[model samples]
Target chain A: MATRVSPAAEDREQEGDIVERCRGFMCPPVTDINVLQGSKEEMRTRMEMLIMETQAEFCRALQEVDGGTFKVDRWDRKEGGGGISCVMQDGKVFEKAGVNVSVVFGHLTEEAAKQMRSRGKVLKGKDGKLPFCAMGVSSVIHPKNPHIPTVHFNYRYFEIEEEDGAKQWWFGGGTDLTPVYVNKEDAFQFHNTLKEACDKHHSQYYPDFKKWCDRYFYIRHRGETRGIGGIFFDDLDSPSQEEAFSFVKSCAGTVVPCYLPIVYKHLNDSFTDEEKDWQQVRRGRYVEFNLVYDRGVKFGLATPGSRIESILMSLPLTARWEYMHEPAKGSLEAEMLEVLRNPKEWV
Target chain B: MATRVSPAAEDREQEGDIVERCRGFMCPPVTDINVLQGSKEEMRTRMEMLIMETQAEFCRALQEVDGGTFKVDRWDRKEGGGGISCVMQDGKVFEKAGVNVSVVFGHLTEEAAKQMRSRGKVLKGKDGKLPFCAMGVSSVIHPKNPHIPTVHFNYRYFEIEEEDGAKQWWFGGGTDLTPVYVNKEDAFQFHNTLKEACDKHHSQYYPDFKKWCDRYFYIRHRGETRGIGGIFFDDLDSPSQEEAFSFVKSCAGTVVPCYLPIVYKHLNDSFTDEEKDWQQVRRGRYVEFNLVYDRGVKFGLATPGSRIESILMSLPLTARWEYMHEPAKGSLEAEMLEVLRNPKEWV
Candidate 1:
C-alpha cells in the first residue's frame, strides 16, 4: 500500500466492524476476529457464526422466560480455539440452563477417530492423526417446575484435512424432550414442531431421525429410553452442503417454538413434593445415560484441552438416586415410565 | 430304620442348620443353602460366606452409628446365582448407606475377560468365554454431616475355569474416603488405620496399594484423586491363596475403624447452608468418578443379568452440579481441592 499499512494494523482496524456485527452474541466469536472477517466464505467460519447466533438467541429466549440473565464465561483452550459458556442458575423458572458454543481446532486423536468410525465416518489420517476443526452449539435446560419437561439439543459441524490436503466434512445433531410427568398434548406439540422442521427438508427425516433418537438415548441397563423421542441424525454429508445446512438451520430455528409453548403452559401448574422427587430421580437416569453411554461426553472427557464445564453442563442441577425406586401401579409416574420403556410415535 | 433320606430331604435337614448359622446375616447367602453346605471347602462357597458375613457386619455397624436399620432385598438372577442388597436410606446421620453381597456364576463374557486382562490378569478362555464364579461385598456410606465425609469399600474374589480344565483365581478390592472439608486428623486417622491393616500382611503393602488406589480412583478430567489414598490391590494371588485371602480380610476388617470414628467426631458439627451446598457439589464429583472411571461400575453396567439397583447403590441419595463452581482462594473447600489435586501421604 502507498501508506505501507501492516496486516496486523489492518486486522485491528477490521476488528471494530466484527465486534459490532457480533454484538448480539453471548461473546465474541471463538475464532480470531481477523480470521473470521477474512474467511467469511469458509464453512468453518459460517458454522462458528451460526453457533454464536444460535447461542445468543437461545439465551435471550430463556432470559425472557426466566427473568434471569446468563452468566457468560469466554474460555480459551490451550491447544487451539475457545468457547463461550452461558449459564442461568437458580432462576425463577429454570433451575439450571446452559448454552455453549465452541470452535475448536486440533489434531484429531486416534480415540476420537475410532469413535467417528463407529458412527460410520470414514477418514484416512497420517499416523492416526488428522488436522481438524469442530464447531457446535449445545444446550440443556432444566426447569424448576416438574411439569415443564427438560429439553436438550446440539448441532455440530466437523471438518478434517487429510495428508493429501483433501477436506472431509459432516454435520450431526438432535433435539429431544424429557418430562417428569407425561403430557400427551405437550409431547404432541414438541414432536409435531420437530416433525414440521424435518418435513421442510425431507419427509423421511422425521421418522428416521426420531427412531435414531430413541435408540441413541436408551438407558440399556434400565431398559428405558431417556425420554420421548424427537429427532436425531449424524454424519449428514448429503446431496449438497447447502441443503444439509438449510435442514440444520430449520431444526435449530424451531427450538423456541418447540419448547417454549410447553413451558408457558406448565409454568403456572402446581406440583407436589412427590412429583419433584420423581424429577430428581429422573435426573439421576439422565446423569447415568450421559456419563455411561453418551458418545459426545466420552469424546469430550477423552479429548485434551476440552472444557469439562461446558461438556457436563448438560447435567441437571440436582439429581437423586434411591435404591430400587419404582413408581406405584396406575400412578401418573408409572404411566410416564411405561412410555419411557416403550417409545411412541407422536406425529 | 436308616430313614433312607432322599437328597432333597437331606438338603432340607441341612437347611435348618444353615438358617441358624445365618441368623445374624442381613439376608441368607446368595448361593443355595444345599450347595453351600456341600461345597463348604470350595473357594466359591468360602468367598460367598465371607462376603455375606462382611455385608452383615458392615450394615450392622452403619445401623449402630446412624440408628437406622437396613431394608434388605434378597433377589435371584435367572441365569445363575443371586444377591442380597441392604440399603439404609434417609437415615439420621447417614444420608444413604448400601451394603451388597452377591455370588454370581456364569460364563464370563469377552468384555469381562478383557477388563480382567487390563488389570494384569492372565486369562485363557474358550471362544472368549470362561465359566466364572464371583462373590463380593460392596458398600458406600454417605453421611449427612458435611464434615463427616463419605466412605466406600469393596472386597471380592474371583475364580475362573478354563476350557482345558485348569482353574485360575485372584482377589481384588479397596477402601477410600472423600471429604467435603479437609481435616488433617481425619485423613491421618483413616490412612493409618488402612496402613496398619496392610502392614499386618506385608511391609510394602501399604505404600504400594495406596499408590494403586490413588491411580485407580482418579477423576482424570478434573485432574484429582477421588479421595485420600488407601489400600487397593487386584490379582492378589500372592505367595499363597491363603495369604492373599488373609490380606484381603485384614483390609476389609479395618473399614469400621477407619470410617466410624470420623463419623462420630463430626456427627454433631454444625454446618451452614453453604457448607451443605459444598457437600452436595463434592457428591457430584463422587458421582463423576463412579460413573466415568470406576471399573467395577463399568463391569456391572455392561454385564447382562446384573442388578442395576445394587450396582448403582453406591451413588449418594442427593447430588448437585453447578457450572464453574470454584472454591474461593484459600477457602476450606479450596484446601480440600488442593489435596485432591495433589494427593498427600497421610500415614
Candidate 2:
C-alpha cells in the first residue's frame, strides 16, 4: 500500500474551475491480474485491489478540496486479516475525513456464521472451518463549512467458500447525505445523479433501492431521518452475479458525481457562529444513529477481534447534545426537522 | 407530584458550607401509598417512593454545589406508570445535571419477557399479559470545571408476580466516577468511602461488587476501562428480598461520599484550555459506552411506549472525537489514561 501524498496537491486543485477540476478522472488503479486463474482466493484478492484503489481515488478527490492530506495506518488482525485506514483532520474543507479499506479473510466465528445463514449458504472450509472473505471501502466526511453537507458512502463484497470449490457471495452498500441546512436543489441533484446510475442497469432499480435507502438510514429513537436519502441495496445476488457486480461498480462511480457538486456549490458560502453551532448539534444525531442503530457498525463491533479504529471511522470530529433541543418553530432549523420527520420522493 | 420549585432555591444554596448545605435535605412528597393493602401493585408503589425520595435528595445536594436549581419535567407512559425528571443546566458547577426517577409497571413484550427470565420467573395477567414493574433513580452529572470529575449512579428494584400470589423480586444499582484527570489520592478516597459502607453490611461486598463494576463499565472496543471502578450488583435476590434491598440502599448511600469531595477538591482549581479539551475527549468515551454497549439503555430504548428523554439523560452536553488521538507521554492526560488501562486496589 502506497502512503505518500504530495503536499501541493490542493494548490494544483485550485488552478482549474469546478467542472474542469473534476472531469476526465481515470478509473481507479487496478493491480490484481489473477482473476482468470479460476481460484476463489484470487478473486477475493481482485476485489480487495478494487476497493483499495477506490479508497485511493476517493481520498485524492477529497484532498483537492481540503488542502489537507491523509495519514495512513496499516494494521493487521491476529485472527486473519488487515486493513488500511487513511484519516485526515483539520483540513480547509473537511473537519475530519476517514476512508478505510479492509480486506479480511478468515474462519468466521460461530455467532457471525449463524447470522449469515439468513442471507445465503455458509460454505465451510475442507477442515470444516467457516471460511469467509470480506472487502469494503467506507468513507465519512465532516466538512469545516456548514454549507458543505456531510456525506457517507460504503460498498462491500462478501463471499463464503466451501470444500467442493462452490461459492456463495453477496454485495452490499450505499451513499447518503446529511445537510445542516436543506437546499431543495441540492437534494434533487444528489438523488438524480444516483437515479441515473441505477436506471442504466434496471428501470425498477432506482425506485426500489431509493426506498430501501430511506428506511435503512433512519434514526428511529430521534424519530427523524439521518438525511435526504440516496440509494441503498444489500444481499444482491438476485438478478445475476455479473450484473450485480456491474451495478455496484456503477453505483460506486456515481459517488463523486452525486456528492462533490454540492460541496463545490457551497464550499465558499459563508454564515454565522450560530449556524456552525447548529451543525454541531445535528452531528450529534449522526453519532447516535451509527453507535446506537446502524446494523453494519454494530455487526462490525461485535465481530470478535476486529480492528476498532477502522470500524469507528464514521464518527464526526465533534458533536453536541443539548437537553431537550427544540428548534424555533417555523425557522430554517425547524423546517429541516419537519422534512426529516417525513421522507419524500426526491426525484 | 408537586411541580412548583422555589426560584430562590439557587440563592439559598450559596449561603452554607459544603457539608452543611448538603445535609438536612427534605424527602420528595409521596403521592402513592397503597402498600399496606398487601397487593403486588402497592409494593411497587412503595419502591417507587424510595427511589423518588432518593432522587430528590440527590438533586438537592447537587444544587448546593452548583448554585443552580433544577427544572422539573413530569411525564407519563401510556402503558402504565410515569416519572419526574429534574435537570440542571448552565450552572456555576455543573454544565448539565440530570436526576430522573421513574416508576413503570405494565406488560412486557414477549421478547423483553423472554430476556428477563434469567433473573426470575415471569407471571402474566389473566389474558396472558406478562406483568412487570420497575422503579429506579438514574442520574448523570457533568461538571463545568475540567478538573472536577463527571459522575453517574443508578439504583433500581424490580418484581415479578406469580399466579398463585407468590412473588419474585430483585435489586440492582451502582455508582461510578469518570475523571478527566485522575488524582490517585482522589481515587482512593472515592473507593474507601464505598468500601466502608459495604463492609458495614458484609465483608465480601466491597471486593466482589468492585470487581463487577470494573468488568461492567469497561469499553471493550477501546481496550480500556470506562473509569476507576466503584461498586455494581444486579439480580441480588439471594438470601432474602429485604436483605437485598438493604444492600442496594447501602450502596446508594455511598454515592455522595464517593464523588463529592473530589468535586469540592477541584471545584475552584484552575485548568488550561487544553485540559478542558481533554475532558471533552474523555466525555466522548462516555457517550460511546452508553449508546453502544450499555445494556439498560438498549433495553429501555427497545421497550415500546417508553419515555425517551428520561432514558437518555446520561449523555454529556458536549463531546469531541479526534481521529486516533494519543496523549503525550508523561503528560497529566497520559497519566490518567494509564490508571484507566490498569485498574488498582484503591483502598
Candidate 3:
C-alpha cells in the first residue's frame, strides 16, 4: 500500500510566512524573454552558467547550516561544450554525498531523437529529424546521520528543433526526502516550503506534482516507498519559454528553505545506535528492492551514459538477519515495521 | 552455491582394513527375525536398548579419537514413549552437537493416515485408513570444527496392515551423509560400500537406490545435490516380508562401517581456520536456502505437531553480501557460481 503525500496543503501554510514576509528576498526580479530563445551559443552559455549557479547555491546552504566547507571533487566540462558535473563528499553533516547539477544542450542524433519522439517524450522538427538540446540539474544528498533524512531533487528542460536550428522548450524538477524516523513537523515544513513555491506558478501544481513524486519513488517488490514525497513534474511546456524556465528555477530554489532547516533541526543526537542498525537493515531492504525491482535502477543501468557509483550511492553500510526474527514486541522497530506494512498519509 | 562431498567413499576406503566390519559382526548375530517382530510393548523396550547401545558406540568412537572421555550434559527419554535425546556441548571432538537417533513406532491418527494416503508420499494400508507403525533412526553431526564437516544419516523401517489385517508386512531402511568439503575418493568409497551391502541382496539395489539418495537431498534453489550420494530405498517388498526385512537390514547394516572410519580419519588436524570460515559461510547460505525456500521448512512450519527448534536444527552460522560483488576473476568462487547457475551430473 502506498499513500501519496501532497505538498499543496503544506505550501498553502508556508507561502504567507516564507515567501511574502521574508526579508532580503527578490520576487519577480526581471523578465528576459529573448535570453531563452537567442542563438545556440548564447543558449548553451546561459544554461551552463545557470547549472553552476544552482550548484553553488546548494553548496552555500550546506555551509550555512553545518559551518563545514566542501571540496569540489570533480567538475568535468562536457566534451562538445554542454554540461558540468560538480561533485562533493565528506561534509560534517554528510559523510559521502554528491550534489550534481547538469545542463547539456546539443543537437540530438537522429536515432536518439527518433526514439524519444516515438515515446512522445520529446519534440521533433519538420524534415523528419530533430534538432535537439537538453538541460538537467540533478542532486542526491545522502546524510551520515540516519535521522537527518536523505533527500533528492532534480530540475530539467528539453528542446527539439525547427529547420533553422530553432527549438521549443519545457521545464521540470521536484524535491523529496527519505527519513528513517518520522518527524511530523519537519516533514510538514519541508513540503510546505515547496508547496508555496509551486503555488505561485499554479494552484494545482503542488498537489499534482506531489502525487507524481510519491509515485516516482515507489519500490514495488516490497510494496513500500523510497521516501515521503515532495513534488515532481515533467515535459512541462509553455508558449512562453522564459516563464517555464523561471518556474523550474523557483522549484529548485525552494529546496534550501524546505530541506536545510529540517536537517539542521534534526541532524544531531536525535537517534540511537539501535535506530541506526534498524536504518541499515531497512537500507538493505532498500538495496534489494532497488536492484531487483526498481525501474529507475533498470533505466539507469540500461542508459549508456550512467555512472555506476553514483547510481549505487544510496545503499547503506551494514545489515543483518537472525533466523525467523520478528522485531521485539512493543519496540520502536516493531512500530516502524507496522508503518512500513501499512503506509500512511503523513502530510 | 552448495557442493556435495561424500564421506561415504572415504569410509569405504578405510573399511577394507577393518577387522570387524559392522555388517559382518552385527547383522549375523541378530538373525532372529521373530525377535524383531515382537509385540508393540516388547519392541519399544528392545528399541530403547538399541538406542542406548548406539549412543554408547558413538561416545566410544569419540573417546578413542580424542584420547579423553566426553560427557553427555543431559539424556532425557520421552514421557509417553520414545528413545532418549543425548545432548553434549563443548566436547573435544564436538561442540553444540547432538548424536540423537530415535526409534519411535506407533499407529498414526486416522486423519494423518488419510492425509498420508491422499498425498501418497509414504506407504498406506489397503483399507485407505493406514494402520501401521514406523521407526526411523536419524542423526545429525555438526562438529565444532567446520573442517570436520557436518554429517547426517538416517535409516528406518515401516510395517502397515492389509485391508483386513490378514496380510501385514514390513520394509527396511537406508542411510546417507552430508559433508562440507569435497572428498572425491571418500564419496566413491561411500557409494561402493553401500553397493557391497546391496550386493548381498541384489545388484540393481545399489545403482537404483544410490540415485534415489542423490535426488532426495537436492535443494532446488541451489540446483545441486546436498552431498555425495549414498544408498536409499523404501518398502523393498519382494515375494515375501522376509525378503523385504533382509534388504532393509542389509542397507541399515552398511551405515556404521560405511561412515565411521571416514569420520575417524577426517575428524581433526586436516582443516584450517579459513576453510572453517568458508564452511560457516556456506552453512549460512544453506540456512537461507532452507528457511526461505526449502520444502521441509515449509512442511515443518505448517505441521501442527512439529517442534520448531528440531525442525530448524539444519541452519548454519554465517553469510555475507559484499556489494555488487562478483567472485574473483578466476577462482573457486567463480566455479561455484558457474555450477550454481547451471547444474550438472557430478557422478
Interface RMSD of each: 0.5, 1.1, 8.3
Q: What are the per-residue Cα lDDT tens digits for candidate 1 across A14-93? A: 22355566887887788887888898767787778778878898899899989989999999999988889999999999
Worst 10 residues of 2 chain B by lDDT: B4-13
Best by TM-score: 1
Of candidates 3 and 2, the better by DockQ? 2
lDDT of 3 by residue, A132-239 (tens): 556666676666687787777777666667776666666767788777766778778888888778767667778788888778766544456777778887768753
TM-score of each: 0.93, 0.88, 0.47
For residues B1-347, could you state the per-residue lDDT of candidate 3 as single tens digits? 12212223322222221223333321221213343434323433233334444555665565565555543322222321233333444456654344444443345556555654674545535645555555544555556665465655555555566556643444544566555555556666676777777766666677777777667656443455555557766555564654554455455556566776776767665667666555554554454344444444555455444444444434432233222334566765455545434433344
Error of 3 at B306 (Å): 25
lDDT of each: 0.86, 0.77, 0.54
Question: Candidate 2 lDDT, tens digit per residue, A164-225?
Answer: 87888888988889999889999999999887777777777788888899899898877899
- Cα lDDT, model 3, residue B4: 18
TM-score for chain B of all predictions: 0.92, 0.87, 0.68
- Say which prediction, candidate 1 or candidate 2, comes out ahead on TM-score: 1
- The DockQ-based CAPRI class assigned to model 2 is medium
The superposed Cα distance between candidate 3 and the true structure at residue B131, in angstroms, equals: 35
Candidate 2: where are CA atoms >4 Å away?
A: A1-46, A120-127, B1-46, B120-127
Residue B288 error, candidate 2, Å: 1.3
Local error of candidate 2 at B138, Å?
0.7
